[model samples]
Target chain A: MHPLDEALQMQQQDPGLYTAATHPGYANAVGPFGGITAAQLLQAALLHPQRLGEPISQTVHFAAPVNEGEFVINAQPVRTNRSTQHWLIQASQDGHMVAMATAVFAKRRDTWSGVDATFPHNLPDPQSVAPMQWQKRPEFTNRYDLRYFDGVIPHELSGQERPHGQSSLWVRDEPPRPLDFAALASICDVFFPRIMIRRQRWVMIGTITLTSYFHADSALLTQVGSDYVLGVARAQVYRDGYFDQSAEVWSAKGDLLATTHQMVYFKD
Target chain B: MHPLDEALQMQQQDPGLYTAATHPGYANAVGPFGGITAAQLLQAALLHPQRLGEPISQTVHFAAPVNEGEFVINAQPVRTNRSTQHWLIQASQDGHMVAMATAVFAKRRDTWSGVDATFPHNLPDPQSVAPMQWQKRPEFTNRYDLRYFDGVIPHELSGQERPHGQSSLWVRDEPPRPLDFAALASICDVFFPRIMIRRQRWVMIGTITLTSYFHADSALLTQVGSDYVLGVARAQVYRDGYFDQSAEVWSAKGDLLATTHQMVYFKD
Candidate 1:
């Protein structure tokens, strides 16, 4: 069966509710790079996007180790405001809250103003895309659809491009997952700092706490859209063996649809 | 009076750990940059340069607030090994531990192998030499030598700059004061993220938590030195009027001296 088909089967078994997903790569040890990377848990619960493309945001708090087992995730839309919707998500195992997140979502509409910019100009020309650590072993995990927006591979191994200043990329459910607006909240983790840091090696996960803000006016891509928005992120704190990354993404038209932040393990 | 001379006199007047000279900008609030900047704290704590000069690799948590006032910062080198050194620094206000930092210092050494070439070119070109932040803010807190290694001009009105990526700048006592390690620890706040974010606009203020790490083999510079090492900082989270920042500084030789991570009220 097609991998996308498998995703559909899983969702059919248990729609996009408080579901459980396994850890990916080095994230398995430190508990999903600080428990429930924005990608793994945000879509767990949502009010079901009112429209095909609604804006969303999310946050997660790590309660404990999720270890190698099937944990539970609960996501619910907390408040739907005129401009945005708020969500609260929790990941648990054995009936205990393993991790929790609070997020915001906005409706997608047509408007424009403020910052006008495209992806950073000085970046490596997209002609040099290559497979990276996490993306390299696509056979390992079925949960990730980590693709670059303009075919911009954030790999340091190729020995060419480095995370100069800021970056952006596209990410989606590996088809058939029926991801909702809430999932878009967590899906914010696609092209980020930590992943690009070890562009050459493995995706060094160091995200601990994640908070995301979304704009409802942004159009949603019902069918894993290829349009990627750009955002600015930085590794704010790198202490001991961990580091934190934060960013705000603007739609292709520069509407601040969502802002995402996280803590990732940084051990070389 | 020569800035250095005035600072020396102040040190004599109130001989306490973590004492820094006054700047016009810092004068209005507390030390400098309203409260204090990490650059001043680290620069004042330059007496033991060999111990404090390594670049900060990461910050664990920046727990409390160190406001502007006359106080003492007491720091002790916690653990120093060939690879890392740990320290315990405390900011006491009226005899209470108002701020505390547990830092880990790392040594950025050179070997025939590994990936130094990756980060070198990306390290902000210090020579593109824009007038130091202090230079632009001639009317503001003009008491330090704040060179934005990767500078930002926070809205132009305040002569503050917010670099896109990690902020790297050379900070030193302008009215150069005679400071030790403990005193320098308290001063890290001056260049912190919350303060940096204020450059964007006003938000609500919330409680912030911060942590720091010191590596082994660090060479502290708690005294007046020739060339300065740069302090690198970034913000991890900023939302709900609350945000956290992570940062560290390296000596001119690239030794990881101290690192800091803090969360503070994002008062709008």
Candidate 2:
């Protein structure tokens, strides 16, 4: 099995309850990669027997970091409408809350459609861009292939103005797994902290909350199967002790796959 | 007292519980304005004695339409760190979930800061723009003084290609209320549905999930007190009965006050 799929694997204990363990391959400095945790939490909802349709929006709040080993997920369908459903999911370790999330799923119908936000232009093909080579990389970083167009990691704290904190990159699973909602959810958080790009120095930082809006349907994902997707992320403003990051993920063919935003806590 | 304040008023029942009524002044077709509900949900956290600081991010899901009259809000702080806190807020009517939200609050401190996203450029001052006049407006529309610079409502559904679904306007309370987090939260949703602007037609539409990242602090809000803030909203894509709207709220002085995004359900 692919590492991501293996890491996200779960056993259902009840209708909306499941148990899973953290994958050592995806370990970060803390518990596990936040994206993996996010994927696992969202997987609980996708696996629910009462799920109405594919997820269109999901928001996850990381209240506490997870520990190694087993954890429990409680996915509850708070409301189910004729064509839409809402879920409230929580992950806990030792009966203590570690993360919470809310998701929206719907049975989509044909509609008048168009894209108002344009895809990034003037970028080289993914195959031509050199892949990122990290020094002292985390286990999770090894799970994917990353190629940067801009905002590469600095060798040392520049201590100079690094204006326009933006990173655009092409990314795909290391073992080349087909694109899926779970994989897409995990990919949304792949960008390193914007602060690291902006200040060129590592600071104590963690994502407090992250929200992702998936635009691609099953057909779209299948079309992007086992291919690199372009991701662009930038920080709007860094104020006080919190900052917000806005990101867009696009398929190689220029289809917008997902848009995500998160609020991070930092201590300088 | 301001109608917005009156509409968001609540009576505390417990440490994490409060009761509030929907204000008719802000009623839409089926329920009170979603922005008001979002503000009330955030207010629940703001009012909690245990809350550590101001909110930096909030996500609210409209599980069901809230009816007129009283609703119960449960705002519990699931986790609290030294400088950051996480909250789970839910609004219910008759023991059924009507809305669910999560919030992150932090005690902001002075930090290295800058804005990467540019504010909209080249527009007449609010005083020069004519206020929007509605022939048949919702009650909530009357609560604001809106002056549009672009993407005004078309006299009729053109049925032609309405490209670039965007709206830029200057808006504030009709009677002019001072800017605050609650009022700012309400302002985030002031833009008429993007579909109405895109397709140039009235469609069956409702927001399923809305997320707002507050960028300005109390000090900044005070500086822009009662002034018309510029709001620019645009749709990224509309697909399969669902679409996403992205918006940025700016102070008259070009300060980005907040950025908001929402997924709306639409029927063609």
lDDT of 2 by residue, B88-197 (tens): 99999999999999988888899877788788789798899988865467899889999988998855556565777899999999789999999999898889888888
- Total colliding residue pairs, candidate 2: 0
Instruction: Return the TM-score for each candidate structure.
Output: 0.46, 0.97
**What ranges in model 2 sit over 4 Å off?**
A154-157
- Lowest-scoring 10 consecutive residues by lDDT in candidate 1 chain A? A4-13
Error of 1 at B35 (Å): 5.4
| Candidate 1 lDDT by residue in tens digits, B22-43 | 4334443322342343333333
Query: What is each candidate's fraction of native interface contacts (fnat)?
Result: 0.00, 0.89
CA lDDT of every candidate: 0.43, 0.89
Best-matching candidate per DockQ: 2
Error of 2 at A192 (Å): 2.0
For residue A147, model 2's alpha carbon misses the true position, in angstroms, by: 0.8
* Candidate 1 lDDT tens digits, A239-265: 345444556554444345555555444
Measured as a fraction from 0 to 1, the native contacts recovered by model 2 come to 0.89
